[model samples]
Target chain A: MTTGVRRRMGVEERRQQLIGVALELFSRRSPDEVSIDEIASAAGISRPLVYHYFPGKLSLYEAALQRASDDLAARFVEPKEGPLGARLLRVMGRYFDFVDEHGPGFSALMRGGPAVGSSTTNALVDSVRQAAYVQILAHLDVTDPPARLDLVVRSWISLAESTALIWLDGRRIPREELQAQLVHDFAALAAVSAAYDEEMSALLRRILADEPADGPFADLVGQLIELAS
Target chain B: MTTGVRRRMGVEERRQQLIGVALELFSRRSPDEVSIDEIASAAGISRPLVYHYFPGKLSLYEAALQRASDDLAARFVEPKEGPLGARLLRVMGRYFDFVDEHGPGFSALMRGGPAVGSSTTNALVDSVRQAAYVQILAHLDVTDPPARLDLVVRSWISLAESTALIWLDGRRIPREELQAQLVHDFAALAAVSAAYDEEMSALLRRILADEPADGPFADLVGQLIELAS
Candidate 1:
């Protein structure tokens, strides 16, 4: 890529380019801290030209958030062919990857704070959660989950999210281990819920049946057996 | 209380009164939607006087958030005298009480969004989670917890927060059930962690020893046993 080439970009292309630039900048620092001047300079364009695509900071911030929301939601999309444990582990991998690159922006959006947290932004963030829920449901092949099942999945989603957010603060825990532990956490949640409801009990059995002995779910079982012994 | 009695209040007293007024208003609606003018009116004071007491909306919102932060953290402080399940249930009752009244503001704060989510406000909110961690540690009576224990507690805190936040959206679940489920979740999380670590196993045993048959934690054990048999 030539640095000095002043190639003309189409309107939509320029908008996409600006959103990408703003996302990169916002990802590095909190949205409140990143200014328009930085965004323009990073894009190698004039500030007013950037505003021509976006009317103001709020608009650009929303645009970036929308982009990030789509990207983050896509992380939860997994092929359902593999064991549930493996599928979930891959999902966690992508999630942490997104968190690794977009910590500040994702954290602020998730926490519902910092600059540009309008209703639209809030909805965008929520859509990500909603999307994750749907994807998890699809993986389970269940259209209507039981109440305990609902609680376990939603709680695990929250756990994964909060785990990633806190992990970003200092990353004290090893990433790979946290990822595995999160999968175990999900299995544990479902297993505990299994004891509460018949539907949940059946669902938990069905899930554990397909998992390999070496999978994260089996690791959880092995750990539990250690306690029993 | 007499009707329309305008009593002259002292400086600190007046500030506290204003904070209380702002808290009620913020509790009912998102802080961004609740204007300073509304707060002033709610306090039965002139807008100028309100501004005189607190320079601006952000300052006033911070004051309200600070007060809320203290209230929230206090809810986590159990007597450490009962079965862990009963103690946690009581704490959840108070927590849900806060959520019932302060859903909008608390949700907005916990999610990290909307107006007045400055670094200071974020810190204040974080302090509440930190305090809850300390209080739970005191309940468990552990000076230094294992790494897995740390993960479980912090993850549970995040779980409770997200659970309450999501429940507030439409409250589809019965409040009493959700509250009880939350205590079960804590036990589930700890029980899972116990299988992973010896320290956690011993701790789980100790926590379960004092709990009654009908307690939430025992109910979880009973449910799980039903799955086994």
Candidate 2:
């Protein structure tokens, strides 16, 4: 299978295009269900030409996974402004957008197992988690988080990751609500920590000072007040 | 290498003993790091005897996992009497007790990957999650949960899972604190859902009415109010 409108392209450009194509195919279905031939055909290139870039299917899968891992890490990056609650909500919006687009791939990244058992894949997953953790700490403007603060941030990061993994199954809940609930989830985890630790209490006070009335943090406070009353 | 003080036992009892021995060894170290010979020596039996019960290492590993899985599900079983907050805190305590006892095996159970790629192992993990979910719903007295309630419960389950996984790495934070924080987490996730859903709001009202002044739920509400003020 070849494209009639094929035009000259650089090797790196062609490699990038192939990775994109493989990710698209993998996202629609399991990576195992997608063959190297299908990838070559999808790329409008010959099978041998596909092998010329990557040795085999597994290599190509890992390469595409690497690309996806980077994109996912990039999703957590946000300009530091506004309420921490709003910033996190926006991050979740983009985070779910990634999960929504790459459903199966995202599952594979989080759940590893024998099907995608390469240490390389597991390492990629770890890197994404580490990146998210670092991004959250950067958001908190803390060079060194205290013991309990460390627990709160790490727990929140893991919560967000697992929340996305579970949401990927049928995606029954509205994405917008999950995105907002996750922001609230972070607040809840930190709030509990603040109650137990003075260091976390101070950090939380600083965080809430910037949070607006309409932000998820304030919304959680309002709901708690109503429940208490 | 022989296990001293061996006593004659029935076939079924011997099989259970081997499974227990295998689990104990697997807990201290990765399963791959363990050997069939070591298992037999620990059981004070011959290497071929382990084979008599299980066909191979993978089978023995799975049997150990099955036993561990049942023990974990049992950890969630609590009598239906007290406030849900106290009940959940007890559950977290028992859950962490299991985690502290079965460190590496618990990691293998959660992380899966190629090291433990068998479908049976993955199913065992799924069944444990289902068991935990069902047990939590029973505690709530809800046979059928609303969509958002489903998300809240499942998200809380996942949060508990990842929190435990992260805690196992060096376990720097105090276990008792993590346990209490997890109960607050469930309340937080549920409170967020209740804010938006009438069914959840009504359910939260029932749960909170039975909660005492000193329970985790009351503590969370008190913390949120403190932050707001």
Considering only chain B, report the TM-score of each candidate against the true chain B.
0.93, 0.93
Q: Flag regions of model 1 displaced more than 4 Å.
A: A1-6, A32-37, A46-48, A56-58, A111-113, A145-148, A209-214, B1-6, B32-49, B111-113, B144-146, B194-215
Cα error, candidate 2, residue B158 (Å): 1.3
- What's the i-RMS for candidate 2 in angstroms? 2.0
**Per-candidate total of colliding backbone pairs:** 7, 2
Fraction of true contacts reproduced, model 2?
A: 0.67
The candidate 1 chain A region of ten consecutive residues with least summed lDDT is A220-229
Error of 1 at B196 (Å): 4.2
Q: Write the per-residue lDDT of candidate 1 for residues B149-197, one digit (tens) a residue.
A: 8888988999988788878877866788778878888887887767656
Model 2 per-residue lDDT tens digits across residues B1-229:
5689666899999999999999999998878789999999999999998899899998999899899999999989999987898888999999999999998878866765445557788788878889999999999999988777777787788778888887898787889989998898888888878877788999999999989998788988988898779
Model 1, residue A172: distance off in Å is: 2.4
Quote the TM-score that chain A achieves in each candidate.
0.94, 0.92
Checking candidate 1 for backbone clashes, the offending pairs are: A111-B111, A111-B112, A112-B111, A112-B112, A112-B113, A113-B112, A113-B113
In model 2, the Cα lDDT at residue A188 comes to 80
Please write out the lDDT profile of model 2 over residues A154-220, one tens digit for every residue.
Answer: 7778778777887888777788888888888788888888888888888899989988888788888
